[model samples]
Target chain A: MTDKDFTFTIDGASVTAQPGQTIMEAADAAGIYIPRLCDHEGLRHQGSCRVCTVKAAGRSVAACTQPAAPGLVVESETPHIQAMRKSLVEMLFHEGNHICPVCEASGNCELQAMAYRLGMVEPTKLPYLEPTRPVDASHPGIALDTNRCISCGRCIRASEDVDHKGVFGYCGRGIHRRITVNGEDLAHTDAAVSDHAISGGVCPVGCIIVKRVGFRLPIGARAFDRQIIGEAIEEKRR
Target chain B: MTAPRKARVATVSLAGCFGCHMALLDIDLRLVELLKHVEFDRSPLNDLKHFTQRCDIGIIEGGCCNEENVHVLQDFRRNCDVLIALGQCAITGGLPAMRNAIMHSDDPLRECLEEAYVLSPYVENATHVIPNDPALPLLLDKVYPCSAVVKIDHQIPGCAPSGDIIYETLVQLLAGKFEGFDPHIVHFD
Candidate 1:
């Protein structure tokens, strides 16, 4: 470990993690994987998906949000965590207007991988209430689908705070809600498409869908395949 | 009966359209069945009667619009036993909520007037950018979902809601059966 006396446990196995690190950051440092959707290395802690949630100090909280304390006990992948993540996957399934066949990201999607990871048989908890929504194929390279969004706000916050390419945002009150693509069209046609790299990078969900390149990868082969991200960054300390 | 104990509930909004409210009204016929067990108090529908009965299940729709909506939403948290975000507006901030970016523009009444309504001269004389009605509840600056405002117990999302869900929720509310998502759902995704 890079820092002095930085110690923690994952699944009852004690390990020395970097000092003042998050439980997620510590897990990443040790090459132990935990599924997550709303966390990125340089970006802020979203912890929205709740898939990364762990049992820390005898309670459940987002591993990404819970900062590590010395001798902290963390259960990275317990059956409870698995069940909670599976329920979350079911919620995503029932929520947005996600139609994989028509979606470009069908072959290479994070939600699909999560479903596979969880061995999701069906959404038995909540019934799928598919709301009718229009696709925002308004631009040349990007597509906005409000139906598929879990409202993680990683995209909106990334747009407003990080990229400054604030082309999109969430608006309206409850029930009458949506992720508006700029008060108008967000995908570039005759519009300023903002910085594509920055915009695409910030989205945790595939809400701000890029027209090409992103969705071309083979199934179960995206960057977040199995806690593929965040680990590398935390490992830098080691 | 001795004075009834209070039921703890809250209401919140996320990013979605408030069509959840229209959906909540889908239980209008079933409301007869519901009120037998629990009380329906506090809502936009309570214009004439202000805060009369304490709500057991706080039903909310729409996401947090701005700072004021956040503050007002706490009203539900204060009085209810369990909070239920009643529609898509409560869960994901439905269609109207998608306007978080400057893309959709900030004016909500204008959008409703332009898109959803067949406006006439008699309906409060609304123009392109009509002023907030002093007699009516004010509009928030932006839109949001329910969970953003306060802790939510149950969330029912759709453009509106189903009569069946309200019936089920009422039964559960009366039985004091709370915690977690509702079973007997039709289709989720």
Candidate 2:
């Protein structure tokens, strides 16, 4: 007798996945897009930026940071997750300077794109402000504009683990807190800082802009700009 | 007639671009809408020409470097009903804080004034020359982020935070419904 195929249901949609596949993997296979930040497929999960949070059996968890499980009822964009993410995005927005219109990252900025997708039109209600933002022009190929920084820890983490250059370490505190480069003394000197700190990459938002790479291409022609982040994320699952 | 209540605020600037302050002008259309509910005093915005009394809200930009930023912070705490850091300079010290790691003084101003301008005799004009004062405001010996200064109540963050956050903050304060966040970070040294 021929045996029936094994399958499971997620949010009422039935789909088949490997016997030990995780919920996230199953959902990815089924093409149910779950928004996330902090968990890059190319690297280890840091579980930062809770935007990818989803509800599984009335519990909230990060899809990117979590493994897929079988037969688990999931809710990707529940109100709680959405609200939490909206607040988180707002917090990140307020924590660092992430103005989309003027930022060089523009369409390439994940934070900006996500804010739009979530319809988070209102700005943060906090009245805090940082003092002066230092522009580090030390690295010939990169510039760090601290004002627009979100401090997702991607740069710091990338430096320590991936790039093997611990040039950037955090300093000070709230509103006053910042990411320091090589003790913050002599960054924009020459390629001296870059020579050592040039891990996989310095920053995610072009924060550590490559000096020689300036205006290399038209604005619309950049990596993330030409394609919608959501679309790209969904495409990856396929 | 019921008298209008003043919205308390304080303004400060540390190592900053002042770009966020400029963005406030982008809200030209809503200026009148805002003045209706709030008042501005002791703002570096009105004119750097002089200092005024503290009011309901205190807004600050720029990062703290040397001595002046320190005094300004004290003044805001003493006078303002609420002290709000306005932009990246104040929020994360934006780019200025990046300099705190090192106090290297290429002092771009010195080069532009002492070397570049004076040497360019071919193009130098009477008005184009710079003063030899080692104290010119343009010559920042060192850069700093504002967070190193006084405690900030809430941060608007963009290089200059968006006018949207600024205006929203003002409106909320005017309505007497502002719930600000602590603009301090606890460092474990």
Candidate 3:
């Protein structure tokens, strides 16, 4: 109960977190993986995805934005939370065409990996949306397949926060919400697709892919194919 | 007294590549052991044309892309007590459903037929001819998952779900424990 540090229970395990630290941060520090999409290590807490929703004191809260306090009890591994997460993932899948078999990011995609982590072998009983957003291959180094975007805001946030170039933005709302490039198209934007740009790699799905390297890896040697997304992140923490 | 009856399993491939069946065969030596408790009633393995009797379980290997696929799927549902959709094709429409994106067009199926069969570069001179045989099953406007056509009791997901997944699913089906299938064994290509 110190001023600088406090302990909270997540899934019945006591986890120590620093003052002002969010549950996601503390959980990551404690080697507990919380599924998220819009959240990144360096970005501000947007709390938009809600995939990290957890039960804190019996109320549902987005763990990525919820501050961890002393004696706070958080429930993450419960069937309800997992089902919600699965439904959210399923909603994302239904909203877009996440055909993993032909996707460039099939093995390395976070959305696919998250669905695997949550035990969603088949999509939840939602009918597929099957929206037909065109693929933008205008950028020489990068490609945008709007059909795969889940509206996680990762690229938008990364572009603004890390790249210092607000090249990406979200347009529309609800079912029509989509990622836009400078309110126009990628080719018209000043976004210089570079290897060092965080925007190039921040997308959790195959929506934004760097060209020329689509199928570089062999069938069984891709990122998530070797280790589940959680294990990879957990190993880094260890 | 007579011994207990063996479980009857039927498997079918709709609009999929026969890869899922190959993966099922990948069980290899385990197939012999599995045969002890189950018998194939209408699977490609046994070459049975239709269900002679009611089946305990049915494994569907693809999505519905044409009218015949829908009919076959409905027949499986009617004949089997439990139906398991196997492979990405059966579960998520897989690669065949890529055409589903363009289904809003005027006669998307005809357009696809024209593109692939009539105007394809592989063919010599463009025939500009589309098959319109009455015997052929009419193509659906869009490729649909097995569930879209009929109730799928269970699903095993993968491009061609790995042999391990098929084995585990079979084991679960034989034990009559279908709920809470193991996620570790499920994957997508």
Candidate 4:
């Protein structure tokens, strides 16, 4: 809206951004969704999941962390970029024990929704890791299933920034990387069901679940059942 | 002129619950129309236990959790020109693959068998015997998706992909369209 704002083109459409705004922020404002996993609204962006990888001025960059520059052209939905995003999503599926049929977050999970959006009917390319992760149900009102965690750091951010509990953090590295509680398990920490990190949908996927209220909604009525992810943002263009 | 030879289709439920086959039956009246174009070769719909000849399409409805499932899937891959992994089990190992997470210890299969036959609270096995019948298929260490055991040309992803999805996939595959289902039509659950 001003002369000082940076302007860029994403998939050939012009997008305007403020000086410090990232490519994701600009494209989002312009109603273009660069497929993302780790980056959530209001939370600090961690460019961990490369699902939001985009070709910016001929180089692949994480759109959520990369600052939009004047005259920069970014390609988000090209066949090659889309394939990359699909592969990333597939890797996430293969790395985790994401048995969707029995999963508590089958329909409402952003990871599952992103997989559907990426046209991943089956994750055949990568061998399933099938790692045995801990499931902490000790919390009186919450449950933590680490098998579905993508290590996006959203819960860590939300707990630290929003709830100010500093309850969640990461331990280990590479494939062994996992979310750890401040103390022993979730119950040992200051985590409560009413905490913003738990109630605010910070943990995308079924990693953090509220006890005893799962499967309340039928299959066809859950989030991302009929409406595709990012449809609401894309609707702004209309 | 004689009508074109009907497409020969075979189907099998390996480690699945046969819910997918039920969904296939859920196609309802469309099965009559589908029968006009295709003939069952080894499917349970006709109760044919063995494939007598090469099949045009083989719809597989489960992952390989045991030796029998692997053999059946490999046979399907050999006999059919096209092999489709139908439903979540076949595509991604589904509910059965939940056991794969606990396969870190030695003899994970025996651990699973013991848990089911001896340790489970619902079981009333006073003798604590795990079935070791030689006739029973030997359990694999972990459940594997159909694609891991044999080549899967296409996959339909759902707990039991709706009857409409199964019908459309069959019609499309029969018409020689291999583009696969639209993303919107595909669901994991």
Top candidate (lDDT): 4
lDDT of 3 by residue, A15-115 (tens): 99999999999999888898898887777888988999999999999999999999999999899889899899888888898899999888889899888
- Considering lDDT, which of the candidate structures 1 and 2 is the better prediction for this target? 1
Going through the candidates in the order shown, the clash numbers are: 86, 70, 0, 0
Question: Candidate 1: misplaced stretches above 4 Å?
Answer: A2-5, A122-125, A172-178, A187-201, A212-238, B1-189
| Predicted structure 3: lDDT | 0.84
Docking class of 1: incorrect
lDDT of 2 by residue, B1-189 (tens): 988675644454555666767868866789887877666665566554334654877777766654667777777767776677666556444455444332233444354445455667575656666665667444345444444456555556454455665677677767768754222111000
Deviating ranges (above 4 Å) for candidate 4 = B103-107
Q: How well does candidate 4 reproduce the true complex, by DockQ?
A: 0.64
What TM-score do all the candidates reach, one by one?
0.49, 0.54, 0.94, 0.97
Error of 1 at B84 (Å): 35
Model 3 TM-score relative to the real fold: 0.94
What docking class should model 4 receive? Answer: medium
Candidate 2 residue-wise lDDT at A24: 58
Q: lDDT for each of the candidates? A: 0.60, 0.58, 0.84, 0.88
TM-score for chain A, prediction 1: 0.79
True contacts kept of each: 0.00, 0.00, 0.53, 0.65
Model 1 / residue A84 / CA error / Å:
1.1
Model 2 misplaced regions, further than 4 Å: A1-20, A27-38, A41-62, A73-238, B6-10, B48-54, B102-148, B178-189
Which candidate number has the best TM-score? 4
Ranked by TM-score, the better of candidates 2 and 4 is 4
